[model samples]
Target: MTYALTNMRRVLRELRQERPADVPARLWRYAKPKLDVLGEEVLYRARLMGPLAARYRGPGIALMFHEIQSNVDDELRTGCSAGHLRQVIHAVRAAGRDIVTPDEALRRLGDRQSAPFALLTFDDAYADNRLNALPVLQELDVPMTLFVPTGMITREIDAWWLVLRAALRSRSEIALPPMERTFQCPDLASKTAALRQITAWVGTDQARAESLSETLGPLVSDPASLVARYAMDAKDLTQFAQHPLVTIGAHTKTHRFLSQLSDGEVLAEFTSNKNYLEALLGQPVEVLAYPYGTPGACGEREARLAREAGFKAAFTTRPGHLFPDHLKTPHLLPRIDIGYTPQRRSALFSRLSGFQRAMTTRWGAPVAVLD
Candidate 1:
């Protein structure tokens, strides 16, 4: 029932891109408090069954987080607050799971004698992670992997999503001739709707996306400063990389979706990002978390290219536990998103406990396999 409603919302969301005239209203109607209630109920049930669910000793879980801010309200909606981060850590530990590094988790992936554990990973190297998350993590003595998109560090480019959000915040409306639409951005809902529409189109064509963003620049008040406020500069990245508990990994150069590019383009994304990070940190970088990382954004080909570019492992946004089988296909590991609202802590735990993965797999969700 939860799965059906979730997929229904996903389908409605996709349909909204094509039929914006009606789907948005239906989506709002369908995706409101009722769906939230249903999700909460499901998580409640999963929590009740935690002990029984624990019996299926699968491989450890890799949890992915983006940003950790001092005050989550002031931060972008994409990230969780320091308080939430602590809660997640405490909850997982209380559930009898040890938090391990990616290296340790991978080493113990197929070892049945190994206790169930969780690996923490942060993507995009946001400065807030260093300021807020690092202290908390250090205090708790938890180690985490930080995936850096080298272009952002080098100031060669900004994340397009950040740029778009900043641009929308200052404007009431935006017109994109390429997309043949004018988006209303007078309120949060409209701004989010515009973001979804623009990102979907931009995710498909990199060149056109940049051109459109450039055209929309005047609408943004101080876009450059806005980006700098959120992203880590080269110096910040270098300093963070030297931290003993942080494992630096590649997250592509420009953060473009790999599946949209040609073979040469894909290879360049991995190799160049890897080379830049190695040169900066004075260490070999061996792991990758593909940007965008959805099925439409990354696939087996990108995973193979990541291997060819010399990465020991690659991760996707796919939600699952690290099974023994995943050891055979190291480059295509699955990770669960740990972003949570105040009410969804139980849901986050259900995902971390591997119960959600079991249910989804049993329901025939496609799991990636090595070629």
Candidate 2:
């Protein structure tokens, strides 16, 4: 309790004393992520996300990555090539940062043994992580956590975002149902816009995700092969789990956006997935990464449920450096997402080093982590 109070006071002191510009508190949730991909400057200068602004240097950052595969769209935005994976490991190391697994990250932070460490996490357990990424990570000799969505392995779900990207790229025109609006995909910009629009219509609610998959599947050339080409099957998990550098974790069964589901549904998702992964991996599964982890998708309720579901820790998509206050709320850990296609290595370094997030965050405050 004393330490928690002290941390709160410290955060307030920096917010007022430093008076680092507030881009209308909470806008960072919407703005900080888009600059790297969309490159839009709204509510604050997007370029100001770099070089050094001096704040929010938390214990360590749990850096999130998705597929380490070559792609043209990468709408998931965290997918990168094998070369990109190599570059990230070398770059983080060069910055004098330690790359650790999720368990180590939690231990160090829980004990308040704060240091400039980076926890490399790959979500959705893509097949390319074995085919492409394993070589790169093995060569670099870095430890990382892979969060697997069990449904993907069982062929029960598609990573809808990638499917959307594929659909947009395949045809120049798309006809959206219910609303009956058609999107033109003659270029990248148009395709991206269409992707978001379709997502907004279906991504928020779990009920609509099925509709999205069924609707868009026909658009792709080989819809049935999407999961096969992308997700890691049971065989992959069985072999990969034995690697010294790899730690397997749960990413729910179907990657349903939790906020859209009822409490009972959420609990079921967490427990079932954990049990399934434990059985398959022949090891204890202790960590979790929420699907579509964001303020809109999850909050304290989901965090508490994660704890209830017997997870040692859980992670969110919130972008910030991990701080001591985070110890009070292990289930809601924050992570900085590595760029899908980083334009400048230096600017990315700025983001990875925790400078970019510190600068643009409103009043130098982290996204309201623990109450």
Question: Which candidate has the highest TM-score of all?
Answer: 1
lDDT of 1 at 314: 90
Candidate 1 regions off by >4 Å? 1-29, 32-57, 193-208, 340-343, 358-362, 365-371
TM-score, prediction 2? 0.81
78-106 per-residue lDDT for model 1 (tens digits): 57888888888898788778898777887
- Per-residue lDDT over 1-371 for candidate 2, one digit per residue giving the tens place of the 0 to 100 score: 55335434433543464335663453463345555444422212544543344465566778888877666344434367877778888878876678888877877777664556888888988888888888877888899899998888898875677677788878888886854676656655556556766777774676566666677888898887888877888998899989999999989987888888889999999999999999988899999999978788889999999999999889888778887788788899887778466435645665565665654564367543732
TM-score per candidate, in order? 0.84, 0.81
lDDT, residue 170, candidate 1: 74
In order, what lDDT does every prediction score? 0.76, 0.75
Give me the displacement of residue 361 in model 2, in angstroms.
3.1
Give candidate 2's whole-model lDDT: 0.75
